[model samples]
Target: MARAATATATATASCAPRLLRAALLLLLLVAATRRAAGAPVVSELRCQCLQTVQGIHQKNIQSVKVTPAGSHCAQTEVIATLKNGQKACLNPAAPMVKKMIDRMLNKGSTN
Candidate 1:
């Protein structure tokens, strides 16, 4: 009976470390998963715009966002937010968008 008790204790002692290590690994994975879930989502991996418009009236535009060419996109993108809350992708090569970009640049430089 004494030998059996000692052998049982020995087995439990060896198993305790492995069980603790597994518990720690599980906790780390859960924490990592929660952090990844909390992180901001990137809606699209590629460019946001696929089609482009020729022009838009300055009065109709409430805001403009310009994205430069990079790994995600090959060409410059110009997006205009209209007063009605609609977003339109403008052609970067379009005269109106180019002028708008120039105006925005000049305005920024003066500030």
Candidate 2:
């Protein structure tokens, strides 16, 4: 009985290292696959503004959100929500939009 118990313990001990090695190998393969094939392969879509208007009246604009260029987009985006519950993309380079942004920025700074 003692010999049988000893044999079982030995078997379990030997299998433990094999099981642990297999698990470690699987983890390494999964990590390597993710590193090699995951990030760039998936399409990272950015830059929401496909088209932008040159101007919109200041009073008609309910809110404006300005997003600066970053990893998501190369150009600055100005999105305005109109009082009529419609959203419009404004061209950041446009003279009228630039003036409106400047005024809003100045007003914000003063407050």
Candidate 3:
């Protein structure tokens, strides 16, 4: 009977660590999901100039405009005005321009 008790205790102790690890992993997953859901939606735009430069090997874009649209997590409109007099409005934030705009807007709020 003592031997059986010792075996049971050992098994219980081993199970405790596994349970704790599982709980920690579950908490981490929940936190990550919440963070991702709370993140802002960024939008992107592409114009004639962007298309033209994309074909070139080493072309630099001149001007890009990123504007925030809507109050909620909905789609945002971005306007890209290139140096070549081409304009384009796109929904879904452009990665580079969206980062820049978000940073600028966030900074403006702190002041």
Best by TM-score: 1
lDDT of each: 0.93, 0.92, 0.57
Off by over 4 Å in 2: 1-45
Listed per candidate, the RMSD to the true structure in angstroms reads 5.5, 6.0, 14.7
Stretch of 10 with least lDDT, candidate 2? 36-45
Stretches of model 3 off by over 4 angstroms after superposition: 40-111
Q: How well is each residue in 1-111 modelled by candidate 1, as lDDT tens digits?
A: 999999999999999999999999999999999988887565555898899999988999999999898877998889999999999999999988899999999999999
Residue 46 in model 1: shift from native, Å?
Answer: 1.1
Instruction: Report the backbone clash tally of model 2.
Output: 0
lDDT of 1: 0.93
- Model 1 root-mean-square deviation: 5.5
Off by over 4 Å in 1: 1-44
Clashes of each: 0, 0, 7
Clashing pairs in 2: none
Better of 2 and 3 by TM-score: 2
Query: Residue by residue across 40-63, what tens digits does model 3's lDDT show?
Result: 564423232222222211133344
